[model samples]
Target: MISGLVQILLFQSLGELVSKFLLPTLPGPVIGLVLLVLWLVLRKGINPDLAMVADGFSQYLGLLFVPAAVGVVLFLPQLQANALAIISALVGSVILTIASSAFIARLLSKRESHE
Candidate 1:
């Protein structure tokens, strides 16, 4: 368990290093996740210890939203004041996201079918 945690932290540190030194504009966590994925793909096998650690984290992923939830709660008054605009933006963004995802999936499926 300890080793698994260490491995996770190691992956995170690699991501932080890449973000800080190579791509300062990118979010460290995102970069770290990509790096971890690349590492797993390249290895072509999950390390049992790391897999256990990752599973534990995944189980509690919902808890990760606590900070954002708290922020929203704290800013409720401000959000209420601009509720209409926020609702419009949220709906518009969700629609756009779904449309783009569907379009991309269709394009990928078509390409795969042709191949």
Candidate 2:
């Protein structure tokens, strides 16, 4: 478990360094995740120990959002003031996401059928 945690941190730090030095526009953590994915793909599999550790962490993922929920509670006043805009934005994004996903899936299916 400790080793897996260390490996995760090491990759994240490496990502942060690369982002800071080479990609000013991109976020460090996001870059680190991309690097991790690339590493896993190149290796063709996940390390069993790391997979176990990740699974353990995934189980508690919901708890990790507790602070964010608390933050929303604290900001209820501000949220209420801009509720309309927020609701509209949320609805719009959901609709757009569904539409784009359907479009992409249709395109992919057409290409697959042709192949």
Candidate 3:
């Protein structure tokens, strides 16, 4: 488990380094996750310990939103000022997401039925 965690961190660090040096626009952790995914795909599976560690981390996922909640509290004034714009964007995104998901589901079902 420790070794698996170390491996993840090492890849994340390498990603950060690469992001700093080569890709200033993309986030380092995102790059690191992409690297991790590619590595896992090539290797054909995840390590048991690594999967266990990931599941453990997933348990506390809700805690990760605490900081963002605090940020919203801190920026309440700014958010209020932009409430209309924010609401519009949120609504628009939700509608778009639902429509796109339905469209994709329809396409997939059609292809699956034919197959």
Candidate 4:
């Protein structure tokens, strides 16, 4: 498990390095995740040990949102100041996301049923 974790971190570090040197405009970790996905797809099979380690991390995915939750708390004052704008943006985005997702799902389902 430890080794698998280490390997994941190593891949992440490589991605960070590439992003830093090649594309500083983009985020390092986002680049890292993309590289990791590419590597996994190219490999065509996951290592069981690595898979176990990943599953362990996935279990704590909810905990990953803690920092963002804290950030919202910290910025409560600012948010309150612009509550209307924030609420409008949040609602608009949510509606758009739901509509788009529903549309895509319906389209896919239709295609699948035809097949």
Better of 1 and 4 by lDDT: 1
Give model 1's TM-score versus the native structure: 0.84
Q: What is the lDDT of residue 78 in candidate 3?
A: 100
Clashes of each: 0, 0, 0, 0
Tens digits of per-residue lDDT for model 2, 1-115: 7877777887889889988999978888888889888998999998987788899989999998999999999999999999999999999999999999999999999999999
lDDT of 1 by residue, 17-54 (tens): 99999999998888888988898899998888988988
Query: TM-score, each model?
Result: 0.84, 0.84, 0.79, 0.75
Cα lDDT tens digits, model 4, 1-115, are 8878887898789878988899988788788888878888999988887899999999999999999999999999999999999899999999999999999999999999999
Query: At residue 84, what lDDT does model 4 achieve?
Result: 100
Q: What is the C-alpha lDDT of each candidate?
A: 0.91, 0.91, 0.93, 0.90
Per-residue C-alpha lDDT of model 3 across residues 13-57, encoded as one tens digit per residue: 988998999998999999999999999999999998789888888
Candidate 1 vs candidate 4: which has greater TM-score? 1
* Candidate of highest lDDT: 3
Give the residue spans of candidate 2 off by over 4 A: none
lDDT assessment of candidate 2: 0.91
Against the true structure, what is every candidate's RMSD? 1.9, 1.8, 2.6, 3.0
